[model samples]
Target chain A: METDLGYWIIPLAIIGGAIRVSTPFLFVSLGEALTERSGRINLGLEGTLVFGAMSGYALAHLTGSPWLGVLAAALSGTLFGLVHGVICSLPKVNDIAVGIAMMILGMGLAFYFGKPFVQPVAPDLPAISFGWWSEIPQVRAALEVNVLFLIGAALAVLLWWMLRATRVGLTLRVVGDSTDAARAMGLQPAVIRTCATAVGGAFAGVGGAYLSLYYPGSWNEGISSGQGLMAVALVIFARWNPLACLGAALLFGGAGALGPVLQSVGVSEGYYLFFAAPYVLTLGVLIATSSPTQAMTGAPGELSITK
Target chain B: MPFTSLSRRGFLTGTVAAASASAVPQLGFAGSHSPLTIGFIYVGPKDDFGYNQAHAEGAAAVKAMEGVTVIEEENVAETIDVQKSMESMINFDDAKLLFPTSFGYFDPHVLETAPKHPEVRFQHAAGLWSEGMPTNVGSYFGYIGMGQYLNGITAGHATTTKRIGFVAAKPIPQVLLNINSFLLGARQVDPEITCQVIFTGEWSLAVKEAEATNALADAGCDVITCHVDGPKVVMETAAGRDCFVCGYHANQSPLAPEKYLTGAEWNWAGVYTNMVQTVLDGGTIDNFVRGGLADGFIKMSPLGPAVSDAARAQFEATKAQIMAGEFSAIKGPLKDNTGNAIAAEGEGFAEDDIALESMDYLVEGVIGSTS
Candidate 1:
């Protein structure tokens, strides 16, 4: 009876949580959308994500500026991505195998380097107060959005536009649609795909930066919680669309927040089940939105793996 | 040092990486081939600053000991992964002693591996080893609940609002018992105190932990503690919210020294050193072992600057009583979260007593349910 008002607070908590949690997802999925749009599959972004997290957290702890940490994370992510891209560009290299190796390398490097950062606290990213109108404390806290969330939202729209309306976007779309066509058009498929992969890695790095600089921001070996892998699924579910990636990220964030939100309201009954609610719902959405015939509706024609 | 067997020759295939890593006092036995080989399996990373870290510290102590070589394989889950890790350590390394330090690995993995390698001593933490278990399979755990009790005393005095928050991994007996002990200790200082708990159904998920800490903070809980594998995320989030934090397993003071009040810590150095020494002495380990502050297995971290001197003094006094076996957190006249009585008349329990293992219900001051 005491927690009856939990129902009302749960939505607000989720709204706040979604924006907070979705920042990483938004960045990762957007990066992934760009990479996938270039006819390349970099499954190793998980590794890139974690490396970004470790480097970002460690650098933030050192520089005392969250933005520098973000910059360093993006750079490290770019390096890892470049390696994966070059290796995949080899005559006989399998993108999947190289992706897996890159993931392992990224995690191992992060683990080895992140050992020092396990105990230290880093500087926090600044937040914007959107809840000034609300007198309720919960609403105020929930509405205190991190600046990265705003940047991610704007980037998603910018990416969606750039991918359709820009020459570089046209070149990327052409490469992703057909290697033969890209080569025929003097686009140099490998070069464009490599650049796209590098750009994608930078985006993932920023996502990791958001995680360590803001909400639940700390660098630990287990910090990512498969968020990197989940972002890949999110991109697929979003049909590789940047705007849809934003929506999908928020959805996933809300789902991840479901258990804690319910617990806040005192529904201890089936509490264990509540924690599983997010994953179950995410899977359901992924399954429902992805269909047998409609699976590749907006998919690039030249993407080797998808074909 | 006694040689358990000559067949253990060339057992370990790799060099001890922790030899340079550990600075704690050790025996450092000479003759590489003659050294006693030991292995450890962790459910999570050794740097977790929590349960796994505590055990790793113990293992590190063992590594420093004379005639002992330590091999550690981390992130071994409770599933078949543990079995592979155990088998590899036993077969490839010929580890004479094995400490699989996760609760879930006990019945299925340790139980399956122990009887098969009777010559190899198997020591498990948070496991129930009895007649049903192999003699070589020993169980050892610390009375961390007592430390929690003491920390609760500190929390009670420190809290402006007696609303304490608990972020737990699961409602398993180990976690439930610790929560009860923490509440019991908090209520010892203030009878009106209440603890709201959230279980994330995971051993370690940092984001969920942060969200839970935020939720509890919004719900007006100013003091927070947790029983997850690692409490770093909880401590970070709690301190970020300007709430007082009670750490678990290891001291997270470095994470938030200003906000940290105190923590319930596990000092496995005693248990690990004793086990290794016992084997070297050609003696048998107690099949079931439980230790507390009296034995240096469970310890309370130094009180942070945030705690008042009076609170520290009171907690110290209570801790002394616990160490002296004069105070029992679980005794007669105890009741569950519901109206039903949990302890009947004349019920008695000690700090490290095995009788406290069946803790399934929340105490009166607890604000959450068991289900």
Candidate 2:
């Protein structure tokens, strides 16, 4: 019996997998970038992401509309972000500590609420097939991209423009760079930071929705596998640039797909090692970019890590 | 006259109870004096439709008993957290027996905690408990490879492409055994049939499982099955791609009814109930207990509507042979995928063979590498 074992399947599989896997990463990092740019870091986006995935899946299953699920997820994420922002706005409260607490709370709440939605199938987000020109099935499957991913790609560009070319962008940059300067400028740093964090959380929630309502497409307790936390590292790797976040997410997704792609083509040597590609890439990028004597470029001046 | 008669009846009941208590002093510790509290801890959600769910079903069976009270904790990590859970169940819940149903919980979590609570019994699933381990700690596992072999038979008949796929979590011995058995079962129908396997490297990565399933479908594998913790994603993904699916760990027919083939399901309910019953009757279970279909440790899911009559007949016949100990999945004259000899001619290994436990290679007709 003849088998279609060819080298061509490797590249196609990886490309398709990267697009599919990167959607959540793209959103989470973009959200994290927005939050960090306002001099606050929401490390609890992992929890927010999971909660969003759960709520999004549940609402989609209940309403029979995938778009409604995304909206519900975004709303839940906004609420989670607002809570984080309000709590961090208190005097003497540490943002990192609050973020950690919020992460646990968010995950716990998601698991509790997500129990009922695990078995039911929610409406999935639609995909636009770009492989109509190709006769090959692999190519068609590879080019069949989810709409959420395209939206994420477009959001990345929009965020880049807003952060660089808008009046709101300048205020955010000023507040992130220096608190005293913001106070002198008559801008309430706490209020601006809180609002930024809330919006960032909304981005994360959408990312979660993509996980449960599109790719892999289910509401399970283990749906989000640290993609939320990895976005934190990815934000730094991208220099807090939204466009860079998009590229970095795709890169991570490709690295993640490397193991399974090779195995598909009967290349199983160092298979487990290939699964670690994303984490290794993250560590490698972080090590390569770090400098002991100076703050990281593009890092917010008032960001707690830098301080 | 009524008071005198009631007193006489109470005296007779007391005499009988005292006689039985003295006769079975061994049962004095549990179930006789109070309800037996059995604690169950899972590494994931109880309704995951995979490994944890199978064990949770077992716990449910134990829960249904007369003198048994079951306590359950889910989503507990396989770290010191499990140890804390075991300790809490022992102290707070007064649990006398614990089933930490994750392989990772055995090494230090169960080993360290078992010695501290010498009176409490700890039975871990899929862990190899040796002689040197704590006397109170034991291990139990089902030879689900037999079920996988049966799954392969059904998959082989269902496949029009003559190609099937297996999405696995790791290349561990147990997983490798399942993969080999699945392929071997298919080869029984048509020796020309081939299986391609993809390992996702984690037990519960939903996205990776989906990607692997798609990769297989793209490669033209019409019948797909998996050994992941949760087969829900794989089943759903395969069904979405219009591929026939064979399930693992638990019944996944509800997830994909139309495309569903039969599945390999763990029958832990019987095992758990029997263990609890033994403890209730003042009998002790073995330190290391293992069983296959014959012993009721594992079972095959009902054949779905897609299974052909020929396939059903073969499955039932093979199942009967397995139950009667007349057949084995790993037979003689077998070779690894690399063309290396795995078994000499006339050398067959039964389901309980220790040699089968250290499997490090994929069988012939399986297009994948163990390394």
Candidate 3:
């Protein structure tokens, strides 16, 4: 069959691509949000994503339950983040460098431990159908997205509410805004950051688990495809807001899905250019939203990256 | 986190000094019996429809044979940790035969482990360790040149610019040999064909592979081939970019079917089956068994539909000549990229010089080093 996309395919592809890309971004950006809210930035979550995928796939294969893989991934991710937190908490270590180091360490450990699990056929996460009520095909197609998509949406709303309405959220915001201020209020900065990192790591881990245990039910080196790194970019584009993170992730996902959608319409030429869409969009938004003089509008004050 | 029970069992009693220690001897080792356990250690995550996947396919084939159990560890890193993994299989699971399937693992790990466990057969894929006069270890590889040569032929016939490119992980002799064969095959079709080669110095880096492929494409090399893994990015990147690629180690025609000409494919099933049969029959596992095209171990994938029938016929005829020992692909009035004669006008490189295992130079058009 010819690889082409008629005009009709673009809208559906947009819907499909948005769903596909948003899940990984949602998980990662939310994790980054939580971590940043607790006064830490984890560049190492990318490594956690891959290691979590490996761990999750291996565990699910061995245990014959996908949920076990999810749990394993979350646990592995938390362990990695804990290590990152502990190392950065040292007297003189830079959090950014420690994050980079943890990224490398996490990847090495994943490859080392992941060697035995390449082509395992683990039980994938079950999908929930919201398309049943929608009679129109486009709406149905959009509604029939992965269960994680809805969960991600719900999570965004929950996080937005939490940050505005909850005591714990206020504590996180306090920590993120000013470590000195947090210490003045009798809060332990290290402990808060460590716990936040752990929670963020769990989110990153579940993102990885989604890769091997849902969309692609096997572990391989190329599974993550820089999704973890891109998620980091997505967080900045979303301005550290969880709801904004969801919208940004879906947009990134749609961009990513462009190549396959185009190819389906008999547009095989220059497919690689399409593959660069997500990165291009990420870079564009990053440039558009980020301000050199007024970082206050777009980023948290104490965030090292923004500074 | 790995299976806690494995570490709890403490098969690796010591940690600091793995290289020097004799591997713990295989316990309960006896002659071949009903249920033979074969352990496969892979370097890459399987399922690229490429090298590791081909090996896994072979493992699956061997597993189907009566009374054989295949255990595999995917994505094994090339590190000191492989020793611990080797120990787990030999000392803990009692694998009768071990396939520690990467070129880097040949030294230190395989060489060290061989003397320690004389009973268990060690069959490494694509290393120079022969069944050294009956040492229960064997090294096997295919006439990948057969496939490389075919790729060359396709490149020769198809290139509009007549400038071909090769992206390799390293300039090691094995990779060099493929480059040489590809050049030789292309030159055989048209004498003026020149090749340009670049080495990424690391295997399986999608971004780097893409970069190398792009650099070649930008340098006016319209046709390309690679000794790197996951040419998915390379081929896909080159798609609609006015470039054609001959893939290595798998049937990657589908990835960029329009632009893909043909590729070198490993028939892992052949070597794996032979090793399994040898282990099953209680035959002495030689120190190394150097297998080439004759053993059906190395072969080319089917040419893409784009290849002209005339070229395909010529490829088949040349393959037969190589198989018949009438002509070696590297037999030559050979020259390096500079056109300096490496081999005499009438004589080709000796079997020792240009064989599958020890090739070391870029052919007449390549622009890189083995180191």
lDDT for each residue of candidate 2 in B93-136, tens digit (9 for 90 to 100)? 67999999998899988988888778898989988888889999
Candidate 2 CAPRI level: acceptable
TM-score of 2: 0.92
Sort by TM-score, best first: what order? 2, 1, 3
* Candidate 1, residue A102: how far the Cα is off, in Å: 1.8
DockQ, candidate no. 1:
0.58
| Winner by lDDT | 2
- For candidate 2, what is the total of clashing residue pairs? 0
For each candidate, the DockQ is 0.58, 0.44, 0.07
User: Mind giving the per-residue lDDT tens digits that candidate 2 earns over A131-183?
Assistant: 89977777877888999899999999999999999999989999999999999
Each prediction's whole-model lDDT (CA): 0.84, 0.90, 0.73
lDDT, candidate 1, A1-307, per-residue tens = 0122456778877897898798988998999899989988888888898999989999999988888999999999999888888888888788888888988999999999988988777998899999899667677778889988999999999999998899888888999988888889987888788888898999898888887778778887788989999898888888889999999999889877878877766777887787776678877886776668665677887666678
TM-score of chain A of 3: 0.91
Top of the candidates by DockQ: 1
Candidate 3, A36-122: lDDT as tens digits: 877788999989999998999899999998889989999999998898888877777788888888888888888778867753356
- How much native contact recovery, as a fraction, does model 2 achieve? 0.68
Error of 2 at A167 (Å): 1.2
